[model samples]
Target: MIPGQRSRPEAEALPPLLRPRRRERPAGRRGGSALVVGLLVAALLLALGAVAYLWVVSDAWRVRAVEGEAQRAQLVSTSEQLQQRVDALQSDLAASDARVEQLAAEKARATDLREARDR
Candidate 1:
């Protein structure tokens, strides 16, 4: 017997269930369609991932814009409160000056009356 050749009886002795099945298509032809499908699926996943990333980034920008508007509103409210305080202080200062002027006029009248009595 040759080193690698099988005897005809030995080759025929294997059961049909244990024999290797032959493919209808060649090996090169078999994987081509599957490769295209795999690449398309990969491309679809990549596109979805990019869209999700953009959505997340846009949402972050929206959140930042909302926070900035809130901060601006808060600053405006604070500035208005400070202006009110300034106006109130100015009104109090004007009332104080008026009272001081009235007191000085009364003191002058008293001095004039005293001098008139002395003469």
Candidate 2:
């Protein structure tokens, strides 16, 4: 209501705590923080790659171990089969020997009979 004095602006009328803060420098001057963040990201990626490599190597070794066990099992089965076949062959050989002896005796008896008849 005074003739010469003017009222304060709305912003000035607010309490000091409600005013926005002012920066002396622009945000462009703080570009170094971006480089630091990029380096951190690269480090994280490298660590992840190392972990992946270890996992791959461990998996390969495990697969090899499993394959070796399977091969050994197959070999054992083959050995057992061969042993069974050998046992069967041995029994057959014994039977053949008994047949050979019987045939020899029969031949001798026939020879004797023929000689007596001639006399």
Candidate 3:
């Protein structure tokens, strides 16, 4: 009836697709929906945090395993080097023992020749 307003029949005459829709739920229900969404978001964040924690723990375990392998390798190399040194020392000792025995036998032969000459 007014200059700027359309009557109910004129408003209804528009197509259903162009009609303004009213919210069916009350204003109080909106808060409940928001709370549910917030809880869902929090649950998602918690799950993501758990995944990150597991990833970090797994990486730490892998690092430790690698470090352990490195240490084992170093120990094995050190043991081999030590064994080589021990073998070399044993060979040198054996050579020295042989030389000492040969000197002793030569000294005994010289003593026997001196005794025969004296007689």
Candidate 4:
């Protein structure tokens, strides 16, 4: 009937060494463990997020590198083709110059023959 008395004294029936002991936890200690658990969860989530971000960024970089290589190869091929075209055009220009020189010499000879015939 007392305020602090238990209806059942089952623990008291046991020896003092065998009785269950209960010590009151401070308010701060009880909440401290929960705080630690919450911080650990947050840290876990942060780590996962970092891993996901790195994976995505790395994938993007790989894609960009592959695309860049392809573009470089295409540019190199185009440049080689242009160089071949330039070489061909240069040879044609040289041949045309040689023909012009030959035509000039023949004209000079024809003019000389005409002057001789008139004289």
* Top TM-score model: 4
> lDDT values of the candidates?
0.92, 0.89, 0.94, 0.96
Candidate 3: which pairs clash?
Answer: none
Q: Which is better, 2 or 3, measured by lDDT?
A: 3
Q: Sort the predicted structures by lDDT, highest score first.
A: 4, 3, 1, 2
3-82 per-residue lDDT for model 1 (tens digits): 99975644357798766566588778769989999999999999999999999999999999999999999999999999
Better of 3 and 4 by TM-score: 4
Relative to the unseen true structure, what is the C-alpha lDDT of residue 91 in candidate 2, on a scale of 0 to 100?
A: 92
lDDT for each residue of candidate 2 in 5-99, tens digit (9 for 90 to 100):
99665777688987656765557656677778889999999999999999999999999999999999999999999999999999998898988
Clashes of 2: 0
- In model 1, pairs of residues that clash are none
Runs of candidate 4 with Cα error greater than 4 angstroms are 1-18, 22-24
What residue runs in model 2 are displaced by over 4 Å at the alpha carbon?
A: 1-48
Compared with the true structure, model 1 gives a TM-score of 0.53
Superposed on all Cα atoms, the candidates' RMSDs to the truth, in angstroms, are 8.8, 9.5, 7.7, 8.7
By TM-score, the better pick of 2 and 3 is 3
Model 4, span 27-107: residue lDDT tens: 999899899999999999999999999999999999999999999999999999999999999999999999999999899
Q: State the TM-score for model 2.
A: 0.52
Better of 1 and 2 by lDDT: 1
lDDT for model 1: 0.92
Q: lDDT tens digits, residues 1-119, model 3?
A: 78989666555877998777776998779989999999999999999999999999999999999999999999999999999999999999999999999999999999999999999
RMSD of 4: 8.7
